[model samples]
Each structure stands twice: as structure tokens, then as C-alpha cells.
Target: MDSSKELIKTVDLLLEISSLLMVSGANTNRVNLSIDRFASALHCNTSCFISHKTIVMTVYEDNSTLSCTRVKNIPPYAINFSIISAISKASWTAVEEDWNIDQIAKEIEAIKKQKRYPKLVVLIAVSLAGAGFCNIFSGDYINMGVAFASTFIGLLIFQLTHREGYNVYLRIFSASLIASVLASLGIVFKLGANPETALATSILFLVPGVALINSFTDFLDNNIINGLVRYTTGLMTVLAIALGLFIAMLLFQ
Candidate 1:
């Protein structure tokens, strides 16, 4: 069978790629484009229907007698531009070559297995980011120090929840609450010039900025349902953060 015909016969593979692409945070537009790029690369006629949580794809051969359809259920994933970029590169490479289904599958598997930054570096980066935000807000040196410690410890606690992969909202609340307790130590002991800055900036690292930006981008791209859903999720996270801080203040005061 021709390579192009092989692609049509493997509609499930394309759907899998599309689902994985979205799971890496490409947004709806990028996901649609990449899926079309893969289909067109094989010289096949394709139809794709994608929502926030699912992807449905159909590929058809020229004879119209040969076709396949696939449905993929996508789970929520944290934003990771590295994975998204790698997938885009792989799809483009496939477009430029007579790539088979196994080759494409192998490429994805390799990307998934690629090593990430060291955990120590990641933890330090999170701490520095919180301190940086506090400094940007004109926090005093003492406040920045408190923010740094709180963010570092809070992120460590958050990573524990992520490792277990359960109760996402609960994890957020717990992490923020723990961080708030540490941050509010400044106010409790009357140590920092502006302890409120320390408390607020510590959890800044945990904000769902990627989700907020993507949701607005989706709204502008006319993906309203998904846009609203993502925006709502982010909002709930903000509320969780607030609740965590409120409880911390009540006890610490």
C-alpha cells in the first residue's frame, strides 16, 4: 500500500497525536493546525472535530471506499512548551518525509522520554521567581527573603501532591495554605517592613498564568466554550488561593 494510503488506514494514530498535542498546551488553534499538517503531509482528506476534552478524526483514501475514524479522550495536563514544540517539529519533519506510522509513534515516545531539568534547579527557579515578583512590587529585602523561603517550601509541598496526582484543587489549597503560613510568619513576628507583600508574593509562583493567557487567546480565536471553561478553572484556583490566605491570616493574627 502507498505511504499516503497507510496514513488513511491509521486514523487512530493521528487522533493520538492530536490528543497528545493538546495535552502539551498547544491551544485549540495550534492543535487543529498541527493535525491538519499531519494529514495533509500524507496527501489524505481528513476531518477533525476537537473540544476541550476530546478529539474525533476521520481520514479518507482517494477511492472514498477506504477510511477510518477515531475518538480520543484527553486528560488535563500542565502547560509544557517544550513538549508542544517538539511535537510540532516532529509533525513538520514527517511532512517533509515519507514517514510511516511506526516512525511517527517512535518520535513521540522519544520526546516523551526526554530528560527534564533537574529537580533542584526547578525548585530554585520557583523560589527565585517568587522573590523576583516581590522585588518588582517594591517589597523590602526582608519581605523578599520571606517570600523566597515560603515559595520554595510551598512548591516542595505542592510537588508532593503532584507526585500522588490526586485532588488537584485540594492540592492547590493545601500548598497555598502552607505557603501562606510561612509567609505570614513575618507579620506574626513583626519582622518585615511589609509582611503583606511577603504573604501575597509567596504564592505568586503558583498562579495559573498559562491557563489564563491561553483561555483569553482561545476566546479571541472563537473557541468560546473552551475559553470559558479554562477561564473558570483559573478563577477557581484564584479563589482557592484566597481562601488559603484568609485562613492563614485568621490563625496567624
Candidate 2:
């Protein structure tokens, strides 16, 4: 194939990889690095500006005015560490094997097809984590049970809303409100020694830990603009949770 077509292909591959990384919880630096690695393997040069919602990338060969540029809007954000890790591994493999565009594309498609844990398993594990948090806060078994139940129901609501393509913050708010309200029932029934702790802990599953952590990671890596964007997103998510919890408390009071 001609260099012009090859450059276009290279840019498309870079955008696809970068978009997957961005939406799958990778920090901006990692996305940049992965793009660089893929370009190196393809014998191309690239520059890109990545943001929370889009990537603008350019590709060309050395000493050539022939180039291609594209702007791709990123997909919705979600935490999928498996995709991040797999793509990072694939980037390295591309470098070591001196992969062509077709090979790398196949690898990426395979990574995308990876299976996630079952919904039932995820719900149970997350609920158990909430219960564990309640125990850490000095709650007894009864409070832990309350936490578990609330987390499970809340996560179920979140999954349903997510499947329906509702706005992300709305899904989080609905989940938090439902979970907190359910936890408050323990207080009303006097069912646990530390009912308040259960109520406080049940919504812990909705905390934007990955986003907040990635925000700080980007800041430390000198990706200030992306860091600030992620930080603001995390802040908004926290506010949504807080508002939901506040409404739940008002109901109980």
C-alpha cells in the first residue's frame, strides 16, 4: 500500500486504541504512551491531543508533508481494567513483533471481546465489599447484613439504568438514593447495633474511586488539563451521591 493510505490506516488505529484506553479508565499519559508505541511499530510518527470527550490525532512519515488528521469523539466512560491491561500488553507485543496494522487491529478486537464477570457475581462481590466496609466501621453482623442488602439493590438499579442508557449521574443518583433509603430501614426497625454506619456505608459502592485516582495520576504525570477534567467529573459524581444521600436522610427524618 502507498504511504498516504498507510498513514491514514495508522492514524485510525491510533485513534481506536487511544479511545479504548480513555474510556476504560486509563490515564492520559498511558494513552499517549500506547499511541507512541503503536506508531513506532508501524514506522509512523504521530501527535495527539487527548481529552475526556475526544482525541485529535495526526499521523505522517518522517520528512514527508503527507499526513492525516482526525478527531474522534470518545465513548462513555467506564472502568474496565481488563481492557486497559490487555491493550497495554498488546502495544508492547506490537513493538516486539513489529506488527502491521492488521495484526494490531486483530489483537485489539480480541481484547474487546474478552468476557467480563457475570452480573450476579459482580453484584454479590460489590455488596460484600459494602458489608466489609460496615464491619470496618465497627458495625456488627446485623449492620453488615443491612449494608449488603442495600448495596445489592442499589447496584441492581444502577445496572438497569445503565442498560437503558440513562445519563451517568442520574444512574448514580438513583442508585445512591435507593441504597441509602434501604439502609435507613435498618434504623427505623432498630435492626442493627450500628444502623447509622450501615446507612453511611451502603452507598460506598458508588464512589468514583477510579476516576479520582486517575485524576491525581494525570496531575502527577503533568497532564494538567485532562487531570482537571477528570477531577471535575469526580467532584460532580460525589455531589450527585451526596445529594441522593441527603434526600434519603430527609425522608427518614
Candidate 3:
């Protein structure tokens, strides 16, 4: 009888965890199926306790009942439940408050509207200048200038295309192409003391390092389709930049 009681408590905890995950925009079908499997493991009947956007669970054991309604409110409950749900399931409880979904939505909207263009441009410029300095120390002063010019041109084109509400992929492609073209021009014109150094420095602006990192992370998290798509897109952007440089050099020569 005691073992049966423990089993019911375990099932309740699993259901509670599933509920919290659901509110946080996790895949609902996956969570629900997991909860159902947990309930089956304990040989207990389980049903999800749902509120406006919250989920709870009730468990029955030999005519006695255990309710996990202690963690209330989707966000806070998700945080708290994640912390303690790994221990003895009997201690799990839901709080008795509601999450303000509307307020959360408003906050997200405000964040999206914040000015990010100027900040991004400044960051890109600083990064390129740092790359330039590195090349300078390596005895490639011409490449340093090329790198700076390419980074600046990339930043400008990105800002213009983004402000015009072009597709994000298109903007990224355009910025990379412009940067590559500028660098190639330095090579063609024999600008500065070292064209090779300048071209190398300038090409830094066209690399999609962030996109590659994100794609790798997504792949590790089992989002293979999304990860592969993003990775391919980043690769294509790089190729587009290369293609632009090739075309520009051909025409100039």
C-alpha cells in the first residue's frame, strides 16, 4: 500500500512538471505524452488540471487523493517547479496565483521596438577595427584599411536595407555582398601597402559566425531541420558574397 501511494505521488509530480513546461511555449503534445507515460508507469489514472493557461494534476491512491496545485502562474511556477520537481514528487505543490499573459506580451512588444540598428552598427565597426589592428600587427597595414572600409560599407548597407523593411535574409546577403565587393576593389586597385592584407581584413565583415553558432546550437538541441536550414542559409550568404566579388573583379578587369 505504501509503495502504491509513492507511485501515485510520482505520477502527480510528472504531470505538474509537464503543465509548467506547456505554459512556457514548449511543445504541448510532447509534454502531455510524457505525463501520460509517467502515469502509466505508476499504474494510476491521471488527468491534466488546466486553468486559463496553467496545468495541474490530481492523483488518486487507495481512495485518497494528492493534488499538485501549489505552483501557480505559468512563469514563476515553471521556474520553481524546475528547481524542486526532481526530488520526492510528494512535496510538489502549485501556487495559487495567475500569470499575467497580457503584460508579458506587452513587454515583449516593447523590447522588439527598441532601437537596435545604431547599436548593431557600432558593434560591427568596433569588431572590424579590432580585426584591422590585428592585421596591422602582423605587418599587413593595407589589409587593415581594406578590412575597415569593408566593415563600414557593410554596416551602411545593412542599415539602409533594414530600414527599408527588406527581408532579413536579403538584407544580410546584400550587406555581405557589398562588403566583399569593397574588399575585392581594394585588391583590384592595388590600394594601400598590401592588397592581400587589406582583402583578408575586409572579408571578416562577410563571415556569418553568429548564424553558424546558432545553427550548431539548434542542431545539438535536436532541432535538426531548423539547424540544417539555418546552416545552409548562412553558407549561401557566404557564397553570395564570394560570387559578388568574382563578378565585380571580372567586370573591372
What C-alpha root-mean-square deviation, in Å, does candidate 2 show against the real structure? Answer: 1.1
Per-model lDDT: 0.84, 0.93, 0.54
Residue-wise C-alpha lDDT for candidate 3, range 1-253, written one tens digit per residue: 7655565445445544565444333343345555554455444556665443455565554455543333334442111223223321311211112213233234333433434336566756655774565376572655676677677777678768766888755776677667767777877888766665555555455566655775687677675764675578679777766666566556656
Better of 1 and 2 by TM-score: 2
Instruction: Mark the 10 consecutive residues where model 2 has the least summed lDDT.
Output: 1-10
Per-candidate TM equals 0.92, 0.97, 0.51
Return the candidate ranking by TM-score, descending. 2, 1, 3
Which run of 10 residues does model 3 get worst, by summed lDDT? Answer: 90-99
Model 1 spans > 4 angstroms off: 1-9
Residue 56 lDDT (model 2): 99
Residue-level lDDT for 192 in candidate 2: 71
Relative to the unseen true structure, what is the C-alpha lDDT of residue 17 in candidate 2, on a scale of 0 to 100?
Answer: 92
In every candidate, how many clashes are there? 0, 0, 11
